[model samples]
Target chain A: MIPVITAFDRSPDGGKGLARDTRVRWALEEAGQSCDVRPVSFASLRQPAHLALNPFGQIPTYEEDDLVLFETGAIVLHIAERHNGLLPVDAAARARAIAWMFAALNTVEPPILERQTAVLLESDKPWTAERLRSIDQRIDVRLGQLSARLGDDEWLDGGFSAGDLMMVSVLLRLGSSGLLDKHPGLAAYLARGEARPAYRRAFEAQRTFNTRPGPSE
Target chain B: MIPVITAFDRSPDGGKGLARDTRVRWALEEAGQSCDVRPVSFASLRQPAHLALNPFGQIPTYEEDDLVLFETGAIVLHIAERHNGLLPVDAAARARAIAWMFAALNTVEPPILERQTAVLLESDKPWTAERLRSIDQRIDVRLGQLSARLGDDEWLDGGFSAGDLMMVSVLLRLGSSGLLDKHPGLAAYLARGEARPAYRRAFEAQRTFNTRPGPSE
Candidate 1:
């Protein structure tokens, strides 16, 4: 059965492919899975229906038949585990791949998100600039560790897996921050992920939908 | 084959069970799996050997024969998938359980971690008090959402799964923060997790190790 996933009715990014839905879309495209999209406005996100689907009330919730799953990482992982392309067949290799997913969401992304919080939410605070510097330094430490691990290697492990997908998506958030410019290999790595045919399709789909005119009465 | 997991030689918590290893220990105990522990000092975690096992240089690395995995969420998940107790047998139920794991680490923990950053890393700054209030409010929003979803339920979903294991572990960090006291339901929920026999055993083991004297010559 085809899955249905919820996304922003009008993305805050205006179709930069930065929204979480793009990650789910990319995963489905990689898995050769065709899924339906349901647009949810910011106001409706807090409504009872969205809350039932996702307690966090965030976009990119996946519904397949009787199952409803939120958290983009989990949704992408679900598709990866069920399908072949996103994860390796080997047991050990598969666990390693999943490790990267957690690393992305937990270790790597936290500092990045902090930077965003500082910019978007705390920009009015007097200490915002100093806080941003600290956050950036923390991010740099993670990126350095990651760059070391990924040095001269194409993928994190044996081949491209869900690990790389999540990592690339997380790193893409830094595209505007210019941190990626400091690490040539990581920059190239992100580029490679964007170059994937599946990624292109996912990007275009979210972009088209996000940039479209508001719903008609 | 028995698995071996790595942890801090001396946890910053000094036996409080705040170290990431407790989560892995809890999962192993829950699964009735006996795994060896290899403690790594802070100085050694960044060294080549530990870095090879975990590129991020964090503790709680799981090594079983040829497979080496890190990230507490991934480690608990690996243990859960291999053993019968931590995940539901049904596919959809299993997916939902995994989503909670992501939610715990990604959504719930970030704000908590941010609060920690403010208290531990930036307390000396001039803006600490004002900044902490903002962080606390962000955490409150998440706690409110989680409490609403967990009202009168034993677990996040149908029954206790790895999701609860992870969510409880994440909440444990907030025990000293006083924020948990504001939400009675979540406080009780966390109490339930701590009350588990498996959790108690894991906590005791980590405490024993963390409080032990210097490594044997």
Candidate 2:
């Protein structure tokens, strides 16, 4: 059965493919699966119907038959577990790959999201500049450690598992931050992830969906 | 073979069971499994040997034979997948449980961690009070939503699966913050989690480990 996933009616990023649905789309494309996208407006996200699907009232919820799931990481993991392409077949490699997925979300992404909070919510505050400097230092520390670990590797673990998919998606949020510039290797790594055929397809699909004229437009 | 997990030689939280290792230990106790803990000093966390286990250089990392895994969420998940008690047997239920796990780490924990950063890294800054108020509001939003969803339920989903283990662990960080007090239902929920026999065993073990007299002491 084709899964149906929820995305934003109009993405805040305006078709930049930064909306989390793109991550699920990328995973679907990589796993050789197709899914239908359901758009939820900003107002409806907090409504009862949506909250029933996800308590957090976030986007990119996955529904397949009787099962309903949210949290982009969990949804991607569901896809990876069912399909062959997103995770390695080897027992140890698969577990290690799953570790990377957790590391990306738990270890690396927190500081990045903090930066986003500082930008989106606290930008008007007087201490924004100094706070941002501190936040960026924290981000750079993680980036430097990540770059050191990546070194000359093509992927975080092995050949492009769900781990890389998550790490790259998290890193893409930093595109405008200029932090990636400090780590040329990670920048190239992000480029490599974007260059994937699956990623390209997923990006174009969201871009078109997000950019297309609405009824009012 | 027993899995060996890495933890702090001297936990910053002392013996309060707030360390990530407590999460792993709770999972092991829930699974009725026993494992060895190897304590790593703060200075050694960045060293090559520790970095080899976890590129991010955080604990607790799980190593069973040839497989080495990091990220507390991943470690708890590893224990869950290998044992029967932590995850529901039904496929859909299992997926939803995993969603809660991700929600705990990604959605719920990030804002809490941000509050930590503000206190730990920016405590002396002039705008700390203003920033903390903003951070607290963000945290309260999540807490309110979580309280509404949790309602009077004993667990986030159904039975006390790994999802509960994770959610409880994340909420435990807020114990001293007094944020949970705003939601009595959620506060009781956390107390219920701490009252679990498995959790008691895990907590006592870590408390003993952390409070033991060191050679210098």
Best by DockQ: 1
Model 2 regions lying over 4 Å from their true place: none
lDDT of each candidate versus the true structure: 0.92, 0.92
State the lDDT at A124 in candidate 1.
89
Error of 2 at B140 (Å): 0.9
Tens digits of per-residue lDDT, candidate 2, B8-41, equal 9989988899999999999999999999999999
Candidate 1 Cα misplacement greater than 4 A, ranges = B215-217
Model 2 docking category: high
Q: How well is candidate 2 docked (DockQ)?
A: 0.89
The 10-residue segment of model 2 chain B with minimum total lDDT is B208-217
